[model samples]
Every structure is written in C-alpha cells, then in structure tokens.
Target: MTVTVQPSPRPRAARSSGIGRLLIAVYAVLALGAAGRSAVQIIERFDTAPLAFTLSAIAALVYFVATVALIAPGKAWSRVAWAAIGFEAVGVLIVGALSVAMPQLFPEATVWSFFGMGYLFIPLVLPWLGLWWLATVRRSERVAAAAEAA
Candidate 1:
C-alpha cells in the first residue's frame, strides 16, 4: 500500500500589491512630512500654536501606524489598518471643519487642515482608499480560505 500527502494550500497574496504599495508609499511620505513639520513647530514655536503642532504630531503617528499596518501580514494588521484609517478619516473631517469655522484656534496649519488641501487632498482620500483595499483583501482571504477548506 502507498500513502499520499496533500500539499498545503498556497498562501494568500500579499496585501502590498501595486496600488497597495502606492498607498504605503504615500502614507510613508505623509508620516515623514508630518513628523518633521511637527518637530520643527514644537521645537521652534510650540508656544505660538501648541494645538496645531500637537495635532500634526497625532497625524504623523496615525500615518505611521497605517503605513505599518498596510505592509504587515496577518488579520491583526488588517484590523489595525481599519482602525487607523477610520481615525484618520474622522480626524480630517473634524479638523477641516474646525479650521474653517474657527480659524483662530489654529494659528498654524496642521496636516489635516482644510482637508489636506495643501497636500493635494491625498490625506483626505488615502483613508477611504485604504479602507476599500482592506475590504477587498478580506473578501479575497475569505474566498481563499473556503477554497482551501473544501
């Protein structure tokens, strides 16, 4: 008698595909830009616009987290991506509105100011794109798992 061993299912494709790589690159650039700006603002003129500088730092952190989540493997990273992207979306909307309504509150521009108009609205659009990509990845993962199980 001969025994046969089934080959293990192929792993799922990485989340960092063409568009995903573009997204990661954008997030990385934004993270660096925000962090540098915040550092300069805090170091040189924190007293002038503490709120704006602090918000800039927060935006930097969000970008960095989202970038890492996008590149990292596993469901946990996907969850983190969702959370970070969601927070970024809300932050942009709130900051944009507040900046328009109460410009006095922010003496200097933050990363989310004016809905990231300074950055060609990339910041405003990136989170939505990330969420959409994550949804696609999840659907594909489910399909792959089902196929393997069968």
Candidate 2:
C-alpha cells in the first residue's frame, strides 16, 4: 500500500477582495476621465499646450494600465501594477512641481498638473494607494504560497 499527500490550495490575493474591487472601479473612472480630457486637449488645441496635452495622454495610459493590472491575476500582473503605479506617482510629483515652478511650461493643465487639482488631487493620491494595495497583495501571496508549499 502507498500513501500520497496533496498540497493545500493557495489563498486569493488581496487585490481580488472588496477593497480591490473599489480600487478597480476608481481606476476605471480615472482612466475614462483622463482619456476623454486628453483627447479633447490634443484634438482641439495641441499646438497651444502640446507638452501638457502629451502629459495628459501619458497619464491616461498609466491609469488604463493600472486599472487592467489591478484586475488581472498572477504575479505578472502584480509587477505590471507596481511599474504603472510607481511611474504614475513619479510623473505626478514631477509634473506638479514643474507646473508650479514654471507655469508657462503648462499653458493648460494635464491630469497631473498642480497634483491633480482639477480632479481633486485624486491623481496624486491614487498611485500611493495602488502601491500600498499591490504591496499588501504581494505579501499575502507570498505567505499563502509558503503555506501551500509546506
């Protein structure tokens, strides 16, 4: 006679829980809003504020990537989320500082201008929140994987 042991199943990542659902929803809305704003800015008067409009487009892309990454499964998506959220935070900080120091550089506003003042600073805050969520999810995954392996 022979006996075999099966490993325990892994626990779900934190990103798939209730708070994650809310984060996904917020990211989706931000993506949509930024896309629309950037599209209008680029199409209507690209020459007037090319840099700002370009930054807006970039911000929109970041938001979209972050939203998708948050909903996606696996460690790969977690990495993507980290990259996207990190870039967003850096971009917002740089743009916010530049816009203040050199107002002429931003004749118009990008999603990150004045730390997303137009959006009630959501753009500034979102990336930090996303990073926190990703870190939490990754930690939980590691613990779960170790538990399963044992």
Estimate every model's Cα lDDT from 0 to 1: 0.91, 0.90
Those runs of model 1 whose alpha carbons end farther than 4 Å from true positions after fitting are 1-11
Best lDDT among the predictions, by candidate number: 1
For candidate 2, lDDT tens digit of each residue in 6-124?
A: 76577657675867888899889999999999999899999999999999999999999999998888778888889999999999999999999999999998999999999999988
How far does residue 25 in candidate 1 sit from its true spot (Å)? 0.5
**Candidate 2: which stretches are off by over 4 Å?**
1-10
lDDT of 2: 0.90
Location of the lowest summed lDDT over 10 successive residues in candidate 2:
7-16
lDDT of 1 by residue, 1-150 (tens): 998998877666666875889899999999999999999999999999999999999999999999999999888998899999999999999998999999999989999999998888988899899888888888878888998989
